[model samples]
Target: MMRRHPSHLRLKPLAKQVIVITGATSGIGLSTARAAAARGAALVLAARNEDALKAVAEDLSSKGAEVAFVAADVGREADVRAIAAVAVSRFGGFDTWVNNAGVTIVGPAEQTSLDDQRRLFDTNYWGVVYGSLAAIDQFQNQAGGGALINVGAGDVALPLQAAFFASKHAVKGFTDALRTELMAAHAPVSVTLIKPSGADTPGKDNARNLTGAPIAHPAGIYATPLVAQAILYAAEHRTRELTVGSGGRLLALASQVAPALTDPLLAIGARLNARIAKAPDPARIDNLHHAGRDLRERSFQPGVRETSLYATAQMKPKTTLGLMAAAALAAGFAFKLGARKAAPIDE
Candidate 1:
């Protein structure tokens, strides 16, 4: 029972418009699926897990959602084509497509294998590429413009997640190019890039299944319900870029105005993270998804503080800073407690 305020409900995009959502088995995609169903939109859910997809479709159907689902590894072209086929066969045709299925392997580039990194790109980056092509085809045939919503992240240059960040950076550049081309030629397809911060969802738990480990960062920062509400609003508004998390949007803004300063700031973060990092065995696949879940810790939003330029001088006093640092050490130890049990997945 996810209860939303009246304002949170999206307008039913007319029965003429069908929508397809990838990564719909969980997380942001799952939340969006539920929201879209609530709005009376015909739906198509895509994910690699067949059982999970079926379950989601059934749940939505019980709620009177005109939903169908397909299980496919988005990394493959034929599979993605089949996903679009499922949408067409079940719902007639699609008016919107969301590229939301993704994966992340977080660690130093040196320790992460090129093979594994490429696999991540195959899904995170290429998966979206395939979706856009399909959507463009449908929109071109349908007359007016339809939307393609892409899932992105705030940390385009974060050090710890080379593959993940690289895929997102590629999405940023790809969307830019796609939007430009559409505008230049007057193509009837619209693109929206969604950059959201840590969404509290099934992403980390699912990633653990792939890498057989846990993430090196806390997952609760996402405020999933809030982000989900934002996505629906973005769709109705046809927003070009939507940064949901307040802190995350600020970080993105700072990165733009002062690249030189932000570079060093991240460099400092990387160094601190590395120095404090307890390296997992590079060879351990059975326990190698996201760093054993010991990365859990809460980060305050710090409120609407002064600009980043003024942030350094305004930091907490040295005595308090030292005490906070000591607490971080203790919190880091408490992180180990979160690894108490493995996440259960039907797959």
Candidate 2:
């Protein structure tokens, strides 16, 4: 059983808050940093690339945002601690911490190297563990509790990215367990998990590709900023989890309601992914073992959706649920009326 907090918990507005974001050099983290800074929040950015971190910090600072950068790898517990330490030293303490560093391998589970898989877990799973612990500890000592945001992939797992999906599953489990423990302790902290579908981010480009050909999500690619919006929303709101795309939510629902059918469809989708024809670049340096050079938020994928109604609904669940219920009632009434009209007059 979990106990509620003794009193109401209030989160600071964006302009008055300080945020710490790991993996801030690219993808959702970079986009979130920009969004938060634009909203007048001071930021502490962390990533493996000191130069790129400096560039991002300089850019945000030049725009009149209070920003700091730390070149720390989240895979190492000590380095993760250093990130929190910098937030404490620079901004007195961070109001939110976003664990957004992750890496993936594109291939069959058997084809990928064990070392690579372990390394991916190091950054994805263990990194979240370290960041969550550090943030929780800091929040306990602070005046008001803070938010911990863990970025996870969609709930439905895909074929080629087995290890990556497994890491995300672990992240979800750990986050849930931690949230329960915090509630049991009556702690004034919010833990949120951000589940994003295929997004047009450098992650796919930076992934280790053991497959002979390139790999991408089969469908439903969303813009990186959309995911950033979800993350920032979680920071200010006490959301348990937010799936960034409707496609992802539907797939997750399908898998839960009918895995037998969904499994075969996923297997067929795997075949289509294998036939994409694009070859992996021999010279491209994958970010699994090192930092990626490309720091941009968006990838080259076209037709990236800029918005998600499902994501918007998640932010306002009660109203959305009421609207959905009303629509269902109206549809049922219309169906009955049409059925009566089509029936013969002699009852």
Candidate 3:
């Protein structure tokens, strides 16, 4: 079980919240469903896999969770809309909508075909777009305000998965813009972007593999439950953004502070990490063309990180910011000292 932050205890009970989760058949989405179910929240699960969806829904329902399943592809706007319809028709209007359905491709940018790139965006980018719109419309029409949570990446770029990273960047930008609009209108809607780093999930295995070499999740990966914690947190409390994993936070920070240096480092790290974490080929049955292959709640690998720094950061933002500021200052001082020592002596 993942550790819950102090703030998590402060949020109102989720017993009455009608929560809608896309891609709920596996990974973080399925984990979030389990978390929310434990909290007594009514749920509507959406995914392309009918059998997997039914199995999850039944399992949750048997466990006393008010859960229902909708077999729909998030890539299609109509399917996304249908998901919302199911949420309302079954559990009443959903109080939170999680746009977590996404897919990625593994390969160099140039090597990835335009068709594959476009298809990736269709699920990763367009899926969030459609789900967000539907949730926004529902929230605007309803009496009570609602939360719209979209899962993005901590680092805007990930080596070897250029198209996937680009789509995540798009999601971040789109969500930021939508939040601005909501604030400007004084809308009672909370738009949150959850940025999780690599987690032990079947996502890596399910991604379309264009790379001839085997790929795997890097070391220091976090468990999927940590992300589920963030998702459930967002479902209750309003947050602008929450980034999961310390490694992810560090990479995001480095990218922001020193992009030129960080890019090359990330490229090298990504390549080396993949090579080190190579896994046996599961027949390379990628989910680019469709879904339903590796239906799993967690990946085969056990994530190293036990607790989430993201959760702690979310609860104590000011303290975390102060610590980050101190670290930055210390690093700056060290760099200055190094430069001064390297300078030629006047004598």
Clash counts per candidate, in order, are: 4, 0, 0
Best by lDDT: 2
Judged by whole-model lDDT over C-alpha atoms, candidate 1 comes out at: 0.66
Q: Locate the minimum summed-lDDT window of 10 residues in model 2.
A: 1-10
Kindly give the stretch of ten consecutive residues in candidate 3 with the minimal lDDT sum. 1-10
Tens digit of per-residue lDDT, candidate 1, span 263-327: 89887876564343233445433212221221111122222222221212122246567777999
Instruction: Write the residue-wise lDDT of candidate 3 on 179-238 in tens digits.
Output: 888776666788889988777788877887777666777788888888999888888888
Off by over 4 Å in 1: 1-16, 208-220, 256-347
Candidate 2 lDDT, 110-190, residue by residue in tens: 998899999999999999999999998898888888899999988888898899999999999999999888888998789
- Residue 169 shift from truth in candidate 2, angstroms: 0.4
- TM-scores for all predictions: 0.71, 0.91, 0.86
Model 2 has an lDDT value of 0.89
Which prediction has the highest TM-score against the true structure?
2
lDDT of 3: 0.83
lDDT of 3 at 141: 76
Query: For candidate 2, what is the TM-score?
Result: 0.91
Query: Candidate 1 — which pairs collide?
Result: 198-222, 211-289, 213-289, 214-290
